[model samples]
Target chain A: MRLGPALGWFSRNYNYEVETQAPLQKHSVGSQQRTPIMYASLFEQKVVPVKHSTKFRDESVMKSKRISKFLWVGALGSVVVVSGLAEKVYPGKVAPSSPAQTTNSASTTGTSGYNVTSSTLAPPPASATAPSGLSATSGSSSSGSAAAAAPTAGS
Target chain B: MRQVLFRQDTLGTSCFLTSRVEGVDFERRFIAACETFSERLFELDQVASRFRQDSEVMRLSAENTGEPVSVSELLFDLVEAAMRAATITGGYLDPTVGNSMVGLGYSKDFELVRRDSADGMHFRVVLPSGYRTLVLDRVTRSISVPPGTILDLGATAKAFVADRICAELEHLYSLTCLVNLGGDISCSYVGQEVPWMVNLTSDGSLDPTSDGMLFGIAGGGLATSSVRSRNWLAGGTPHHHIIDPTSGESAVVDFESITVLAGSALDANIASCGAMAMGHRGIIWLRGTGLPAVVKRTNRTQMDGIARPWNGSELEFIGDWPEELVQLSGGVAC
Candidate 1:
């Protein structure tokens, strides 16, 4: 039992017939109103004889070719759409551009450091007095009195 | 000049506003300013709170969908400011530590977490995905994050809000104001002769006699980050809210607290948090930034003893920190 010839015979007879007839039958085109033969015959030998043999084989092959073309196109389109969606959904994972590079390259200012060159320490406010029980003291430059001090701590 | 002070509690912390207004309609303007501050704070919490299931940040975390999510301008600005903080600190103060916070037994609000016992609590080391993974589009006011990346803007949100509110008050009411959210402070300058006096403490205490130092700033922001605050115990181990993104654990540092002064509250907060995360390297980083800072470290020997005096602590001043003016007995003054 040679595997090559057996597989070829199986494909040409069973697979080819199923592939060719399924689309034409689904389209509801009768065998009599067959389109003209467009391409050469794939298999020169015939196992079974039927009416309009040329038309049947030609129409079937043409229809099968049309369907195959459509399938190839549809498959290509699906691949494209799926790829696009994946890119959109998983942008960071898909196109992993370095964050460091992006941050460094960003033209935006005030993103890299404190905006001020140096911190400022001013004298106490004038004309503001501390509430009772809290002592109000001014800094070295005693130009103004002290206001109620705001407390700052870790939270 | 007449000055008014307002205080309220929101966003799980206290907020203070100090304004100096000189006008005949001072009463009405003061009331209106207070109302505006409340509205802005509520808006910030709705958009940025991590504990609230309905908040935009929580929803974004729950969805875990890597798509651009349109958010309010406030939230967008918050995220953008957080990312800027990450950039400035070289990823030391990261916003993408939400999962890390939960894993460290801070899964709920700080107050609630403090109430619950940590006897049988278990945790895993959930490292942050890094802030760089976040994609923000300014044009659309949308943000995108990687799936499973939880962002906690706790480091910068309050400071950002303080800065925003201070700016808003100044812009809208023409008032010289200072806004303090929790420990983050921002003030507006109008060439006034008096500077805003701020008490620096390791713990967030408003008590004037609490062993702390005092400093005066003409304008800008001040923020303090400490390991002593927002700390809890999990499975018999101590944990803090500040998560080191590199290790996915609470930062272990020698200093008990670090306070930074910058042009804005957001900047100050970022520097302080980044310094905390950097540990010993923080001093060098802080010096390099040329911002005024005061770092406090508890004396180990003093802690060993039963009684710990306030003077037992060591304070290091850096980058043009002013000299002590009025010193409280046994406490450092700046």
Candidate 2:
């Protein structure tokens, strides 16, 4: 097929027409480049500029090969992208929000140098300091504004 | 429950971590954990602190050529945590405030900084809300920042340090523990009848703000953020450390102080910082997290974000804290 500036689109679209085909080359059908409409009726090309030799469909085969290769590379690239995201170090999950937090019990086996507690507790006394950092304390005041207008907590 | 208190100074403020136990070995192990905690804080400080020119944070800042720079694992994780806070706060609590701090004469330590008042002073803070510009590669443990942006991991990193210390205690000794970096506090307890008592003054000034009245906590963390502490004079006007990224100015009007209890020191501090910066409307922000909190405003109004028993007369509590009372920072403790 004769090619020119108009053929630039052909290169990008993986549509290559076998420009030089020896006469009676005996080319196999598999050697042709494939277009999306390769199976169209031969009569459809009668109005086109180029001659359509039944044996010179090598361009159509070439296009199919190129298209498949592009797809494989894209699949490989997508896998790499996903793997990268999976390995991201974001600690995204249920943030220790609820009153009960265990830091994923399975992940925390107390296998590290820390010792695990085995003791049970009795409910805290009214005057005792609770672990939640709440309590009725006996301390003098320094910040009047904060204390004077301070609101009591009740639940 | 039995209680033990440990205090030290590191990371630009006082460090407090609590442990509960009875036996003799408990003190020994608790002290050991404290030592490890102090070491970790120093290690992180050496890596993530912007005030120290020799810190990795400064090195990264100096070397930011719009290219990714390999950093210590600590710094890498620190930046990630700060980014998380920036995300949670909708950019109100930014870690990239180094340039903004410097713009306000906070280039040096707080004590070393000169307070000439902020009146009549014209200044521009680059990327006051630019924490999003930080590029972090967790796989490579590398980070990059936009040109002219400052990466300051003050609260996010500081709060995490507290959480990590408590986690470390839980990991090795499994000892009931609380790690407090300045006013940020974290605790871990497997099972106990009596909760840890953390006292707060009625004025909201001396709760974990100090070590006074008892607030009951079984686990998790607590923190207080206030602008009353880090005040400075900028051009004849008092300036503070907390800046509203949107305005590039101190967030003085938003709150006088805020105290929060959450699952970890990281959550507590990040939420409080964000709430403090949001001003009083931050109450809605804190309430959204469902964490228990108290906000003290400049007008001396107290608001509750969640439920807690305000039984003692000495420790006052306002009934049904309003969401729109112009809540401000109770105390700015990062």
Candidate 3:
């Protein structure tokens, strides 16, 4: 198998060679309902039916187009994974922009993991909510007899 | 079977009876019976007692200073019964010995009299009676008596209660029932499929080993009176509560115990108490009653006979016997 790979005429592409000549992977309303997330790639495939005969022929065509469409999507995902690795080696030049950039940026900003550093917060109010039963006449240590009198009423 | 036993230590007597087939609300009936009887018989107490206010004997005692007092129907009935007992026993048992009882120190309630003094260390107190000094008017229900007369009915009240309870239970529950007022037992059998079983022993204080008991399968009341139960010493003399009206003293009977089987346990109880009060001649007097009787003499001798349908032989065992005392062919007499 190694020698076969070395010869140019006998070489086969290691990357996926998708069959684009097959019918456009047109999705039925039932298939779209099954997995709504995967249907976006199916809409991009644009598959068409081979014949308008019985349901058997139409189903085979639909099945064949759906399988190829899935293979194409998997191949595209592999490319994205390889590109991510390449970006890690080459920095910002290999990175995908916009939608992927927003997701990556949002995740990194979430895990700051430090309570000391305030990203964004409001300042404390000038005065706190009033104590219902009594008013502190002075500081926490009680500056005068008025503070004692004000709290003594509660006791 | 349901039973409610009432024990008043003040009276020194036990009132116990068995009830069957009473409906859900039988407590009211039972308590009513107790209250009615207590009202009639509680006079012997020195404390403010119902008997002092209700008894004709007490009324007679009260009027001893001034004019003689006439008796009420309730008091008359009790006194007449006492008189009859005295007459039948030939003064062996007498209710008229009130002064003698009081002199012996039984004047107050038996429970209330304190025995702290050394002089009365061995003697128990009974009320004294002024028996001989009484003028009677039978038609007017009045009696005049001397002062210091204290009447005690510890003997007859139990038997009367047994009879009264039987009558009450018969009317309340249409079933065979028995009331044992301190072992003077009275029973009434409503139906006749089988005879009721009663244990007849020389004394109810039984020992498991000895054949000192008999089973009576009669359908009436039975009572046993014995000096073996209530005995005390007074003035260095061994005296019992069973008094002889003739002598105005405690009875001196030879028998350890005497049981009479009659048509009613009331009859048996009265006869037995009277006989015990009769001293030595109690057996002979009981024999004249024409009822079945068994007497266990103080000398360990015993006599048994079935003089009536309700009477039977003295028991020889403490166990149950299925056989009833059937009357023999030639009609038996006392």
lDDT leader: 1
Q: Rank the candidates by lDDT, best first.
A: 1, 2, 3
1 against 3, candidate with superior lDDT: 1
**Candidate 3 local Cα displacement, residue B206, angstroms:** 11
Local distance difference test, each candidate = 0.61, 0.52, 0.41
TM-score of each: 0.68, 0.62, 0.51
lDDT of 2 at B294: 67
Kindly report which residue stretches of model 2 are placed more than 4 angstroms away from their true locations once superposed: A1-155, B114-124, B202-213, B300-334
Tens digit of per-residue lDDT, candidate 2, span B1-334: 3344444444545555555554456645754665576567667767877777788888888878878988876677677767777777888888778788778766665555533332344445554748767787766767888766677787677767766677767778767666666667666643224444354444444233332333345566667787765777766666778877877777755555577766566677777888878876787766677666665555444555333443232221232211211112222111
- The alpha-carbon lDDT assigned to residue B180 of candidate 1 equals 81
Docking class of 1: incorrect
Q: lDDT tens digits, residues B96-214, model 1?
A: 99989988888776767876644457778898989989998876878898898888999988987787777677667777788888788877753324456666653545433355665
Interface RMSD of each: 34.2, 31.8, 55.2
iRMS, model 3 (angstroms) = 55.2
Who is ahead in TM-score, 2 or 3? 2
Order of the predicted models by DockQ, top scorer first: 1, 2, 3
TM-score of 1: 0.68
Worst 10 residues of 2 chain A by lDDT: A39-48
Scored against the native two-chain complex, candidate 1 gets a DockQ of 0.06
Give candidates' CA RMSD values in order. Answer: 34.5, 32.2, 50.3
Model 2, DockQ value? Answer: 0.01
